[model samples]
Target: MVHLVKSATVPEYASITGVSLGLKDKVVLGPFEVQFIDVDMYWSRLSFHVNGPDGPKLYVVGQGESFVYPAADNQYLNITLTWIRSDTKTALIEIQSPLQKLLSGQKLNVGDTINLPEGFPQISIKLTSTSDTQATFLVTLPYGETQTLVITEGSGGSVRYKLGDVYSYSNYVYIHLLNTTSDGPATVDIYVPKVASTDFKIVREGEEETAPTTTVETVLVYNDLLYVNEKLPITVDNVTYYVKLVSTIPDVAKVEVFKDDKSLGSIILRVNDDEPKNVPNAPIKLSVQSVEPEYKRAIIRVYGPAGAHVIPILRPANLLVKIDASPKEMLLGDELVVVINVENLGRGDAYDVSVAAPIPNDFELISMTKTWSLKTFPAFTNMPALIYVLKPTKVGEFEIGKAVVTFYDDTSIETNEEKTIYSPVLTGIKVYGIPKIEVNGMAYNGTWGNYVTATLATQSASSSPLKLPMGTRTMNSSRMPRSSSACPAASMAQLRLMLEP
Candidate 1:
């Protein structure tokens, strides 16, 4: 005998049975021989009651067969099942839509159509996965009436959905990450290419929330601008991503990266209108297209993840020189000593310093070399005295010419600088010689002779004394004659007395 326990629509449970009984007459028979019959039973079919577009519908599925039901977008359906017999069984169930399909442990690909209900457009699906064998699915616009997608099997998956017109000026990109792993949470990294470090800010999409703070790593720097790579931590899965908004060839500048006074690498970037662009990593060869003009302004920016350092290009050395001659006044044939002082007044060191002293026509150079050479001239310091021994040949006063100091810096050999300084002139040089004098006079003696003769002369050829009369008293007076040609009155009186005595 078979029995039905419950119906498909009714909530109450009831039962019905079919049986065969045999009896000859109505006799009150006592305990006679009795027998019991055994029967085998099984469920024939499985009935599924599903809510459809118009109303509820019924579907019957046998063993090893599947039943697919249609569903609206984002709508839930109530399902009920009824078995024909009391035996247990299994059936395959599927829910499909015009734009998508949901099945048990199955994969779908391009050119596969999702049978949705009427009045709906089929949407194409594309998928890709990365990291830890996980897959990220993407649903993009259809390409040439065909949809392509990739599905990966892994511990986790992600989905990125984008919506906008193909030619719209303003468009948007949406990213969605899904974590299928049984672990607590999966970590994901998002990368956006070709963006600057300071150009864009990150924020949550479609919500009044601040996105996680990102770490910006400077990959390279050109002309004071930054080329950067950003790292973001995606804490949750199946979350959409959106931008908040706001995000070389010429060897014009050379950059050297240093840490703790150690050089790491170097690069050269192109300069456009005094700005550098398109710089790469270290160990790169910079093109020396042209030399930078002297005194032109240039800058090198060196940076990493932590901080940056700047070096300004400027003129390295400034030289100031002065020359001096001792003993301003001297004889015509006297020797003059000249000293030159070369000082460096700039911030950088001066090298290969050479000074050339002026050799005037009136002076003769006694020094072996007129030019002096020094290895280096330190900043704000004077070099050793550059001495020149010269003899003056002319007697007239003359202004000494300037001395030139030429030097280069440590940066390059081609660069050179010069400075000139003038010395005080030589003056008041005189010529001197000895003079000769002669005198002759007549003197009178007292008793022997009325007048005596005296003669005085400076002998040019030999030394001689003056002669006078012997009989006259010796003429003595405190005052001397002014010249040999003139005789004083006092000397005559003394001569008369001498003559009388």
Candidate 2:
């Protein structure tokens, strides 16, 4: 609505708008003239300043209003070859009423005079922020078919801006911070440390006070500056000094920092002054040396701010054992010999280490030995761990899950002590049973047509060169070469031999 300020006596002019003013008198919806859309494909969403009618303005019809042919005279004039889709879809080409047509940051109306900012192009309409910065208002206008007002800031740098009949949301914004303030004549350090994204905007402090600062929808970078009177402290001769400064980014931002040419690292963050930290572990050391001005920008600082490093370790246990047995995998009523092995997995030697085994109901122990070294079994390797052996006479799964080997050592220390190394062990086992192999899949007249024995077994963990099984020659196969007599499993090298022509 536009009110003539010329005199209070002058009646307030209803915005010659369809929604705000009365159009019932001079206009109706009878369709004497169709809405026109001209040169839309050539100039999409472009606005044209049509000189409105001389007398009262024509208003567009809206919801709930009755229709009729516009009363007498062509008050709704512009009947030309144009593109307008009336009463069907949203209007793209707008026909704003007269009043808003003249607003230039103050007030206006159709035919009312408006002074364009000096140096600003008269052909282009634009708006400026509180700080006289460019806008990125990518919003759709609302109310009065459409509206365009030229926003201005006395005289300074500016960018293009289209007006709106009604204000609403637009596209995202971007902001940049440049250091410039009476506070800065010295080096002002700003640390961003972290951020979400970087498309933040700089809003003139005049308005937009409620806009977001740091959001996932935006990005921010800090711009700090050192001018005068600001306490920007620097250390020298083991003493602290201060300076004043001011920093700015066209937009608000948080500054992340890097120095010299590498990432010095983030500022040390502390939750509280009392939290016991282990970063400064007893066995490690960290020191910071006094630095010179030539290296003022150094990330590795030397001074009162020097910090320590701490290593955090938790109590650990690693164990393993391997067992040996006689007549492995025993059968019912078969006598069996078993061996058990255990080891200490501590940093210090243990005491009172022992061995354990489950006694099967049908087995009887004829003899047992808890101590066995190279002297007990001179032909085999002696690992010198806690070992035990027993003979059994029954069947079923025998477990030693409850066996406990106890020991004591200095688990804690307040003074220097010798570092001790104990081998952690994998407790494994070997059992014994007899006649456990099954004989099946018998065929008559097979191969040599003779009775023979086959001994099948898996090899040791040691990597000894594979040797083919030795066998007596059969009457029908006595002339085969050694390679073909009996071969080891077809490994990588053997596969190549078999594939050879």
Best by lDDT: 1
Query: Which portions of model 1 miss their true places by more than 4 Å?
Result: 1-312, 368-371, 410-501
Per-residue lDDT for 1-501 in model 2, tens only? 111111112111111122111111111111121222122343323222122223222333323322212322322322221232333322322121111112222322211222233322122111211222212111111110112322121211111112222321111111111222222211111111011111222223144433323222111111122222223333333443322222222221111222223322222312111211111212111111111222121111111122221111122222334555555554445555555555544323332333344444545666666453221111112236443434544334554333333333333222323223332332232333332223222112234333323333332222323223433322222332233234443311100111100
Residue 26 lDDT (model 2) = 16
Off by over 4 Å in 2: 1-326, 370-402, 412-501
Candidate number achieving the greatest TM-score relative to the actual structure: 1
At residue 499, candidate 1 shows an lDDT of 11
* Per-model lDDT: 0.35, 0.25
Alpha-carbon RMSD, candidate 1: 34.3
TM-score of each: 0.27, 0.18
